[model samples]
Target: MTQHTPHLWSRLRYRFDILMAHGTPVLIGWLTAVCLAIVVPASVVLVGASRDVPTTAAGWGAAVWRSVGQTLRLGGEVGSPVYVMMSVLLALVALLFVSALVSLITTGLHHRLLALRSGRSPVLEERHTVLLGWTDQVFPVITELVAANADRRRATVAVFADRDKVGMETEITSRVGGTGATRVVCRSGSTTDPTLLSVVSPHTAKAVLVLPPEDPGGDAHVVKTLLALRATGPETRDCVVVAAVRDARNHPAAALAAGPHGHVLSVDDVVARLLVQTSRQPGLSLVHQELLDFAGDEFYVVPVPALTGRTFGEALGAFATSSVVGLRRDGGGMVLNPPSDTRVGPADRFVVITEDDGTAVLADTPPAVDEDAIVTARPRTQAAERLLLLGWNRRAPLIVEQLASYVPSGSTLDVVTLADAAAVRGACRPGRLDVRFLRGDTTDRGRLAELDVPSYDRVLVIGDRGHAVGPDAEPERAADDRTLVTLLHLRDIEQSAGRELFVITEMTDDRNRLLAPVREGADFIVSDRLVSLLMTQISENRHLAALYDELFAAEGSEVHLKPAADYVVTDRPVSFATVVESARRRHECAIGYRLHAGAATGPAHGVRINPDKREPVRFGDRDTVIVIAED
Candidate 1:
């Protein structure tokens, strides 16, 4: 029995340790047990020592109750010195145990609060938006989401990224300002970790937007994040997921990782295409901004039962406030700028551009068309022209490709960049354009003068990313400042030549656009802002994915700024209904017209979209009409 005593004590000690490790509640239970052990035995001893203790069970219970009061220091009966000294000792023991219990509860509560602030707790929200990853695009995306939720009573946007939870919240609050009625919750952790990604509860979210990081390997990380999101559960498969890739090569991989219901886009391709289109056509950026942002007019797919069996041409003037841009066939295909005589099926939906979903109401009667004011003049034939490109970056090659596909054969393009001439030539192979590269600094006035800036039909200044910066410096600002200096030199040259140049400047930040030199017929393309707008739009409505895909592609119908004279008599005051009718005759849809007088003005910048059809206006020879057409 003595030999086994040590083994038995060891086992009991192990069990006691296990019990104590159960946290505050277990410690409290043990404290109560210890208190009862001392109090009850002391009560029995005091009752037995009492001089006049009764022999009955009731008298013995009364005596023990008096001892309990003494132990708690509530009161004490007149007893001998031995009982009094023992009661004092019990009170001291009670004080020690009670103090430990309070301390445990306080420390436990503090630890739980810290855990919550660390973004380790799971979010319990339904139908919220989940944003993964972080970039400069988060500001605009969050701002637009707030605007999108203006009609709802309550909405939430939960953010999960590998950043400080408090820091993320502070930056968003500073940049986005007040988000009334919309709760923004941020979680910090590595997005690639599946365990961390589950904290935001992506399964219950209505939509998930994966923002591409600014690093070189952002696309790979985005793909991993998408796979991680999928690994969360099958419920996330039904939620709308959208992402963008910086390189075209990663688009297929990203789409596959995003699953069947997810949508992925190539940001480089979209920005490249916009650079090519906007360089030739000024004020087009304003039109795109109107369509992309939620604060202004946007595209909506609405079911128009009134025009189910009507022709596409007849539906152009059906809405007095909205413009019909395309049709979504009931079977599944999208036909944009289709033939005027194309019939709308019963289940087909009209793709209209309007301010709100309920504002696409059909008119009681078709607006009066000014037949006499309509012109039958043909559009000008394509002519070979000289084009000049300033600056260079990773997107330069894609921009060259898009320009080559759109320009006529034999058109000459001269590139003045700081990049290696041989490398530029190797990447930018000509399709229909005669591409030339000149190694020069675009910001130098003497270098820009050597190119004969006024001789080119259009000038493009792309943001350069080759500038060196410190580890703590902002990379985009250095490039944007360089672009601004180049623009200032170009504006000076234009002043000396007495001719306004159609300059298209590419900027990385939307705030820097306001700092760029103001020039007539000039436009700025904030690449990050546009991509954020696209992702937000798709997340809100998944059907727009295909619509925008068709709109941005080279082989499909695209937005064009054509001469207003091609559609209607430019000198006469005619209603917008007349322009719509004239465009329908030429197998096109006229959304709005740009006025040359207002081109340099504030606010609209000469661009008007989805205007009232009954308002009459006169156009000049230089004025252009915004339309969706197939070239």
Candidate 2:
């Protein structure tokens, strides 16, 4: 119904328009050349005309006839061929110069096209490792990595995060700059993408440590990354992929995702077990540091000589430089502070502490027993300990598994939940742990009071990952609030009962830890933050494990609170230096001490571990000695 008007420009003109839009510089160059050509020719012609040189053939014909006539009078036409040859040579030289310039532009485009085909962009060439997560623990992790990699050939680390990469880079550089490092590089890309992952070559990488995404229900990203790598096929199978997970329930899926050689670690059980070790014996992390690190000294599991058969106590001092800690018997069994009577057979291997196994100091002489000391240090009996678990999450099951090894028979666990969900993670059972489920609001004072809280020895506040708590809320904040509220109610109970409670809870926020008060014994496990910190430290200084062992060993070497009555008189205020001098005599490292005033009710009347010697040991009618013991 309408009459169509034709387009002012045709299809070819539209195509030209698009090309001109993109090649404005080229278009400008061509136009400039055309303008110069026209201007030069017109100016020369006009100037010549002004000087009375004709512009047409008629003038040329007249000029030729006149030149002939003039030649007769003078002489000039004979050398005109020379002028023509000179002009041709000059024109050829000009053409060659212009060709070279055009070649330069074409060559630039060729190189760019080649780069596109090959799939790479030229970038910074500094020797900096890259990190790819945004987290509170990132600063510490970078700090430790800087220290670990200080001896690298170059400086600088690159970080790619979910947040602005440049922003993360700037903030980290400003905050952790002073920690010895070369530099930090940042770029934006989702770490899960293979195209993005290629920016940091997994094949030629020094190391790759993946952290759990900030809000993933505990290491979901870590698991996904592992699966991504595994699915990448066999080429990258050998690459070392270290990932930290929060829940053991996800371990199987994570393991399946990790494939054959990758290492998937559950931070929950690892930290929980470590805290539990530190609780029973504080300073466990230090011992692990000593053993895990390459510097100072470390623990190595070495197979013994075929002829080496000696009792455990007798072989304690066998190694010239290494100190024997325990034996890893058979394949799966281990005896950490075995009885002196326990024999180290020819097939048995020893877990000994040394600077390095490559330069091992094997004992040349036969070892003998220090029977009296070993016998005196043997545990009197396996005492029953109480454990209380509040809330639920992925790590709940692993805690139950590791507890079986440390908690003695008859031990009890009271698991308190909201709506009191009754569910256990895969391949798990509470019966083995003597765990009893008490469905109630743990934070409620009356309800918490009704449960006989004072009877429990240890309270573990786990974060709830239930339906009431949205999956998107900050896990750490949610867990922390629950812990604070529960602690308040526990404090009230303790106020009336005048009984000390030992509480160890998980913390998501390292900064928010000061908000809660633990009138009873309490320790917070900031597992995720520390995992990255330890990884970076180990990456740079491989020798840190030696320090770890000295702090975490359960038997023989442990932080303990014993009766000072055995080592020092209570009425005296002995200086810490003097006590250290005394304890060092027995091969123990003295760090700090606890007071006996809190422990006098039971067999352990009052005992503080690593006490300051100057503190009056007024042997409270109820105190004992707190110390580290290398049994």
Candidate 3:
């Protein structure tokens, strides 16, 4: 019997465990049962034992009601000592029951509040921009988006990332200060989770941007995020999804996941092309920056009925405040720097570079063209150049390939890095560029002297990605640190050689670009910031993706900085209109120019885009005109 009693006790404990597992409802039920057991027994004892209590049914009911009042802490009149004693015992049991009940309710409410604040709730926003994943790129993207939304009545940007909600908001607030009329909302979650992606309401968003993370597996996570968004709903397919990946190999998968309406960009391709292009032209990056950022002059497609039958060359002088770079056909094809005879249809729109939309207003009459100031001499013939590349990373091979496509044949490229020479040799397929690799540290002054840095026509420095990517932030800082050190060495070498080096430094962080020791007229390309700017531009208008594709392609009309002498006479002051007209004769479009004297100045960096055409500007012997032309 004793053993059976133990067994029975165990079974009873198991049943209690099951009951407790039922959560708040079951706990509340137990408390109610306890209250009843306390109140009913006390009432029965009071009705039967106390002589002051009546034995009638009505009396019993009154006693039970009094006991219930005592259990609930509501005072009731006591008739006798027995009744008073029963009431006191009921009060003690009631105290225990009330404490347990309050604790259970408090705990449940706390859990509910926590769940609500976990950023798991769905956003109730429509037509808002949704950005997934967090990186250094978020700040620039948010800033650009805010600028893009400046003219809107109301705008919202929802950011979803696997980070703390409050932290993201704080960082954005500090970095992108004062987003006027634009509301930025942040939610915390993983981009690869379908539920998390839905939390930002990507289906109803005006556009969705997927920012690749900073780790080695960032591209993989981006691919997963695209898949997750597709799994969210069918409506997401119709949404304008813009995604970017670090590796070009993952571009096809990302694009396929983004659907036909979506746009996919490769960071390596964009940055590599820009680096290769900017290495030749010093101030071209600043001009590209102005075109890419929203705070300054940018590309806008505006229809003008007045220029319906005008030729593409005549359209250059149609806008006084804007510079016409290209024309968009009715069939959605863009022809940048088209021939002088190319006519604009009634339905075609002009692609003008202006400060803002609607600001590309037409001029009543074209500005006076100084035909005598126009220089008709042909552009100087190209010559083979010697180039040197410092440091090596994942993008090094792409940069080399881009250089091969742009540089003339017989041009030699010497790559100096701490990495193995044979590995880089195997990766490079330099078609036109004569490639040479040397195993040495680029930061070492002795090795750089041996290579004769000043002997090269231009020097390109790329940050090492081997140490720039990892779970830790120190690696990225370390990579930037190495690049800065290399720049310092180059600066010292230039000082010793008494000759300026046309240095184009690739920086991982935008903040570190300011800390580099490069001399005046040097170019710094913050790779991630450029990627963010491109993503923001595409998010605002999907059609711009095709425009950018053509602009950045190797065999197209790209933005170039040619000698001002090639367009107009460099000996006298001339209006920008004259330069435009001169470029029109050569089948090119003149947008702006760079002053060799003010190249070291603040703000504009001597690069002016979309300047006042009627204002007469004097060009120095070394001044260059910014134009869109095919090589």
Candidate 4:
């Protein structure tokens, strides 16, 4: 009949906690009562042993009740007669009930205390990075944190998600390697709950990774988390918060919510951009992997101390181990494949890529051949190509058009898609791509082999719509699985047709690169990691992308794993000094390289790329080095 005060609910929760805490004790007490109810009476009826004897009602009553005091002597057998026996039973029951209650109470208290101690409790910590919704993104975010903190022995990442606490912990344990010094802890809570936000110590976390779930519900959750994290007050605020929106339409809302709180990434827009890039240039996805993987060679802003007054070309050769590929400064944008005269200045940061640690500049690699064999002429190929896309996606058509623009126009493309050929044709821009859609899945090896997959120089495996891999699918492993099977089938077809294939797949994850079973097979688009690196680089400077484009361009830029002998004037343990002079002579940038220490077959047989990297390089005829040379 009456409305309860707000305090009542709080009090009720507290009391309920207490009642639950004594659960063990309650059970013990009930069990003792039941025992006494049965055993006490049964012991009292000792006369039941001689049931045949006729007994008067009064006699029976006296035997059972009147002389009950005699039972006190039995108690005295152990202690103070009646008091001792009663005390024994009562004490045992009391102890059981008390112990059970205490245990239950203590366990709850411990959990509550633990939740508070960890940053999960909102009341204590504020402004820490508050990750809103959690999904696959959590894995990468955690992985990056591990890689980013490689210099440190330990790191801590607190996760807050809608998942159950046990489930969250278990999922993280299973997905992320269990044997890591860095600890990942999860709290069961919604992103919108500011109270739960405290438990993660959001006020202090270096950065928060907000991932939306796979479905629509996850989108709403991310949006709410963005807004809530942004609203934290100034003192406990300013922590970096990064979020992703599933739909492009949610971008503005997410951005507004993340305003000043941190940064927001629109996955759709980025995916579209990468698709356009991958379509134009094959193997750019592999480029993306080297860029995205923190452990592998990736883009970094190295201060070019020796090159304040030098050109990018001179500065590029200045670092013994690291290469100055591009420039980033106060006002200058990223200039990829910059002109030879691009000047390097103090404020200008050199975008150098390296692996494992800070860029370790190796001395220049020596010239493999003399000026006579060094072909200064560009290795120009036949104009354009006839590319056939075995699939369609947001990236497929773009990739076709890109190939057309980047490659010579005599190049024609006939698309093979399950989508409508007529509509695909109608939507097509004139002369860009000749649209011929076939209704079928590329996964079918037999059906796929029938198509001329090898005739074209390039074939892209685009996922079905809504299923396309994007920033989330880095190491585009699944895409590669589909692509690999298609490739294996195509490789067979190519073998049957007596032609070697140059295939490029657009995969989301770089990890899939190793999965392509076909030897020296196809170039893959590890877009996920590539996009990560691109975003990271761009965040530092917007120009890096253009420079990236040039370095990755098919006609203008190239990355070739060259044999060390290719750089040797003679076979000797060579100093990068000789290598540097030779690379500059060749008008090329020699970044880090792989070593084929052992083997007689294939490319860099048993090559070791990132080991004992500090040592000088020597080359045998069996080994090859990767060089970025202009065509």
Candidate 5:
């Protein structure tokens, strides 16, 4: 029923706790001094007040001073029992107190070191590239950025993720090998945390890559990261924010959060469109890779004063080394493979594919056209074809929809999957395609054999997205494994039948693409890698987005590998200029050629883009010419 006031010592202890909680050096020093003041004097007094001590004040004072000196040195004379006992007691007390202080200091220092290693410290960098979030795509993104800045003396790429800084660095180094002149810095932090985001100095960064996390709700995480980036401040508002979202539904919200400077790439939609496009054209993936990756010829926007009054067609032949693919309007927007008659304005810039920006220069005189070799021919007519689709994923529906627009009316497509046939059937349009669903494991040799693999003109193997969701399975790795199994079975089937069957396989990870078996008639589409490449390309030059959209669309001009016999006399030596002249007569642009014999090999396969027109090359009957034409 009655309340008692707090004790003085208890109050002092509470105040000391408050000081320790503040974690300031000044308060810590004060606490240490207070501890020594109380402990040292108390130990000395207890020693002087012992049972056989002197009675005079001066004697007691002298004895206490001697005990203090002995305790400080942790040693004393052994002859006097009282002095010896007091010295031992004082020494024990002193050792205990000093140990406690040392322990406290050590623990505090350890925590501070942990914080520093965990990337709590702010990064001081300018004009760097900031990568927020971590996924399988980060490796490829870093590799591309390294190649993008290969010409620079030094470049920095700061990565902020909810992961261990050392672990991230180790993994990147192991996977990427070397970053050349680009220095990659990793910071452990949450992508959605604004304060943690500041560790990468986003305001001073030239660009930011918001990679979607490897989780079920990746789009949600991407959207949150975009919101955090948008909230950074006005200084970062104009900085390019390139993010990839897995779901189309979150695109609008992500875009709104990203504001005007952000470019949100829909991974699912982009992969689906690419699959649909590549399914019909076997070697198209190689063209996209060459254009997207920095290791080979890539797109470059260069201004040419001489091309001001020239038409798009006229400008095409102006570059001997570079291949003019499109033009960027003076005001805005990009038109890829535009109409031949489209006139280039004074302020227009040519978007050409070249090994480097400097190589995009226009030649003083265009290569001489071979009039005798120019054989004009009509575009090939559409014909009904059979397609076999193995496996299924979220992109299956979108791929079917896009494929429906490209195939002929009577074309038939058979989809084989372990998923529900009705669900797969629902995603397809019966009006455009004669759709049939077969329930089976696409990786099983028996199931693949039942589908008559050799009968289908083209076979597409879709990576299993569901396998990655299983317990103890990595999404990208699992999907890639399934894809690899299916590809191996398809290849065996082709080899046993002694027939060449066109195959396009989807891979979730770029690394797995390298592990895929080398088959003469197969093409691999690494979904994540391609998306990463496109994101990087667009991030570097936003105008390329329009060009990519047009290239992947069902309509418009697309790159194709046509038979060499269709344009030139096979086995006859002719310059690439003759092939270009021949393609121009048909209202199509001939960028390069594909050698059928080398099509299955690695690196360039048989695809050659932007070759020197003056060089004399011989084409076999089986070889194909690479051109951009509307079907």
Candidate 6:
């Protein structure tokens, strides 16, 4: 009997499992039907057992109706004990059935809601920006997009990743605060999965950004995601796609995967180049940030038929507010800071620096040139520099290579790191630079003091990349902490010696940049944040890639912040048009000026770009003029 009972219960449990396997709606409906079946029959039996009910069929039907009414507390009265008992029994049975049914239905509905919150449902947005993959780079990209779309009536950015949708939303909200008019939506799914990619409605998207993951296998994941995006139908495949690749070796493969309409930015190479450039020029990073970010003056390409016959040099003075930088050829090519004699072709588009596209208009009359204030004498030659590079990372080698091109012959570069010196030497090419390496921990004050920090003309602090204890550990945080410690020591040593030292530090995250000790004269290169801004900018304007490439490369005309005294007399009020004329006399383009007294302050730190050309401004002897010239 016991064995038979176990078998019977097992069969019943199997049948119940099958019934529950049907989805939420079906399960709720089945529960409702089961409750009704039990309640109705039980009510009929109770009526038959009642004393006041008759035995005939008509009497039985009437009694059953009365029993149901009594169970529902609608028709019957509490008369005799037997009648009362029968009513109470039927009422209890109905209560039990209703309680079970409500519980089942509520449970089913809750589970269904949970499934929906998992981001499995498809989006119905059009002309939106779609972001694929999740990493530390996502927040900066979203923030930049929000600022870029601030003027729009409505803008939507949809994010897809293999993470919890609710969690992603919460983290982004906590980090970014209010998104203004831009709506940011997050979905949970693998970026490489085609079935899941459809949920973001790629066909309706206007642009797509693919961010590399934080793991070591980031390149593989990015390639797969790009491939998946390309596999989407022709409608989505034609949309503009921008991706970031960490390794330069993967550029060819990623570019191939991205096809003709896509732009692949090598993050390591870009950051390395920026670091080397900023090391020489203290405020160069801020200039790059202003050009890339939407909150400041950004690069804009617009067709100006009025200046079709003017020379590129003549067109520079045509804009009252916008600063003309270059021209875009008609057949989809870009030239930044072209030769002065280059004529503006009929089909060419002017690349001007302006607050917005609508404000990039040409002035009716060019500002008057001040020939007396212009200086035609060339600046003195650059002497050999004593450079000290502290710490090491993947970008260290590239920094050395780029630095070699800028530094003069007989310049000495000292690289100090805990890493093997031989390996560092092998990676660098011996140009005119006298390169040497020392193995030591940079965070130690004693070790730093031994290097004599104040003696070097420039100091660069590189964040450690090997601080992570495991594959999933947070390494950037630890590396930044170490960098902060090293900066504190360097600042103390410099203050004790009472001398000025130009310092440039590389940071992994933007939030930590504010926490560094030496904030005033120091420059910070937030690798990921800059990359994120560049990716977003290129995704919006593809021609910008070529413009920035020329700006960062060593062979072209680059932006430089020269002494204000080099252009005009100090403390004398002079119009910006006079400064422009002075720059032109020296075969250069003057964009703006920096106030030395206010260089350490907030906001723009006295770095003004694209000022009104007709306004007269007084410049101090120590102030610097922002210009573009061949060095």
The per-model lDDT (C-alpha) reads 0.86, 0.57, 0.86, 0.57, 0.81, 0.83
Residue 527, candidate 3: how far off, in angstroms?
0.9
Off by over 4 Å in 1: 1-98, 235-237, 467-474
Ten consecutive residues with minimal summed lDDT in candidate 6? 465-474
Using TM-score as the measure, what is the rank order of every candidate, best first? Answer: 6, 1, 3, 5, 4, 2
What lDDT score goes with residue 399 in model 5? 75
Query: How well does candidate 5 match the true structure in TM-score terms?
Result: 0.81
Residue pairs in clash, model 1: none
Which of 2 and 5 is ahead in lDDT? 5
Please write out the lDDT profile of model 6 over residues 174-258, one tens digit for every residue: 9889999999998999999887898998878878999987676898899999888877666344467899887777889999988
- Runs in model 2 deviating more than 4 A are 1-129, 150-156, 174-177, 217-220, 227-239, 256-261, 275-375, 383-386, 424-433, 467-474, 492-496, 519-521, 537-631
Count of backbone clashes, every candidate in sequence: 0, 60, 0, 56, 0, 0
How does each model score on TM-score? 0.84, 0.57, 0.83, 0.68, 0.81, 0.84
The lDDT ranking, best first, is 1, 3, 6, 5, 4, 2
Q: lDDT tens digits, residues 367-393, model 2?
A: 332222221222368677788877766
Model 2 residue 436 distance off true place after TM-score fit, in angstroms: 3.1
Candidate 4: which stretches are off by over 4 Å? 1-104, 110-132, 192-199, 216-224, 233-241, 244-287, 304-307, 331-343, 356-375, 379-381, 431-450, 466-485, 507-517, 526-588, 592-631
Regions of candidate 3 where Cα sits further than 4 Å from its true position: 1-112, 235-238, 466-475
| Candidate 5: regions farther than 4 A off | 1-112, 235-238, 467-474, 518-521
Better of 3 and 5 by TM-score: 3
| Model 4: lowest-lDDT 10 consecutive positions | 466-475
Alpha carbon deviation, residue 622, candidate 4 (Å)? 13
Question: Which 10 consecutive residues of model 3 have the lowest summed lDDT?
Answer: 465-474
Which should have the higher lDDT, number 1 or number 2?
A: 1
For candidate 5, write residues 1-631 as lDDT tens digits: 8999999999999987887787788785896687668757976677667887778876666566566556456564454668778877888798889999999999999999998788778889998889898888899999999999999998999989999998999999998989989999999989898877888999888888898876778888988888887677674554677888876667899888887778888877888888888887778888888878988888889899977887888887887888877789988788777788999999999888889988888787898776766554547788899998887877777778878888898999888877766666766766778888878898799888888889998888887666321222246678779888887887788789999888888887777777777564357788788888988887777777778877777788778878887887765688887887777767778888888778768678888888998887788877888887887
